[model samples]
Target: MQKKAGPFFYVFLALFVFFVMFPFLWVLLSSIKPLGELFGDKAFDWFTSHPTLKSYVSVFVNYPFLRYLWNSTVVATVTTVYTVFVAAFAAYAIARLEFKGKTVILGLVLAVSMFPQIATISPIYMFVKKFGLTNSYLGLIIPYTTFALPLSIWLLVTFFRKIPFDLEEAAKMDGATPMQTYFKIIFPLAVPGVFTTSILVFIAAWNEFLFALTINTAEKYKTVPVGIAMFQGQYTIPWGEISAATVIVTIPLVIMVLLFQRRIVSGLTSGSVKE
Candidate 1:
């Protein structure tokens, strides 16, 4: 029989949860604090005497924050779709196909992912400028897809390899074409991993700042991160507004994970064991 967790285990777990959640709780509390209270003597107090929605109101009214949010949604959604599509094909090929230098190719992909964006940003910017793609969705999409591809491919390859080859063989014997086999058989079985990869890719694209700031300098195309950064003025920073925006931007992602956490956990662990 498996052993039950002891009191110390529960204690440790509680501490871990506190460590993870304290920052967010502080930010949440800060977002609702009145500006005077935010800078007052009791600034570090857990709860404020005066709480107002003015910060949240300012986030929407004082700036074109809605447009910035829409821009982020567009870029992140498009980047996730194409990145997953292409990664699926590439991963399927690597996992199923017999080819020369397969290991080397995988290694190269990982190496490319490890390359710092700072090191390559200059060349990427020049390339985008040359094609007049700067300040466009395609410009950010191209780079987001590039950076996200390697991780997605790597994760999907593991899941694909976990699938039994006998399934593919059985499909072939029934006169199914390779494409049909993959679409009807392989793809459905791999949905968990695909879903997990999609969430991760979307988060990465959503939170991306350097490329978004660099490639899309046009105010209309600026994403949430850039928009939040711009909340600072000539001599003052709007801490409450920034905190409110942070809470607003983070809630959806938090809810998404909470809803799909089971699938995410299963997808991550399914490929861990050998069949």
Candidate 2:
């Protein structure tokens, strides 16, 4: 039998929800506010006197927001796909096959993930510059993949270790090649881990600001976060426009997370559980 919830639990939960949601609500409110009220003394007003879509309109008219969205989408998608693809094989190798220095390799992958991005910025910039990849899709994609791969590999390796050994043996007895067994048996069973890793990688690449800012000097190649930061006026900052742009870019992420939230929860929990 389960105990009934008390009023205190509901009260605490409400407070926690409000605490977490206030910033998003504030930003949402700011996006629709009239520019005058947004910047004026009424800036902190909980509710707006006048709400309009003018700021949203201004964003598209004044900036190439769509191009920024496109650049982010392409870079993030490519990064997630490439990182997951490479990490899948690497993880499989680490989890299933016997090899030398396997523990050392796993430790190294984790170390790379823990290494600060700030520390690598200068060297990465120099390397990318030497290859003339600055202000290009490949420039960001490569670094994004590098940062995302380690974590993805670690997650997949841990998840793969949870899978049954008999699955592999069964496929082998059916005259399946090693590659066939992996693709047909192991790979299909690992979709949850793959999806979870892809979500994390995609979000990290999509919201990555420092790398995007450093690698792309041209406005045309700027991602959404960088582009939103660069939106300004000679005299005063356009808060409404910035908020509107932020809301625009943030909506897709929110929707994506909402739709796949169940899968994400299940994937993460499944990976964490031990047999």
> Clash pairs of candidate 2?
none
Return the lDDT, model 1, position 82.
89
lDDT of 2: 0.88
Candidate 1 TM-score, true structure as reference: 0.92
Over the stretch 60-98, how does candidate 2's per-residue lDDT look in tens digits?
A: 988999889999999999999998999999999999999
- Please give the RMSD to the true structure for each candidate, in Å: 2.1, 2.1
In Å, residue 187's CA in model 1 sits off its true spot by: 1.3
Q: What TM-scores do the predictions have?
A: 0.92, 0.92
- Model 2 spans with C-alpha error above 4 angstroms: 1-3, 232-235, 265-275
- Please report how far candidate 2 places residue 209 from its true position, in Å: 1.4
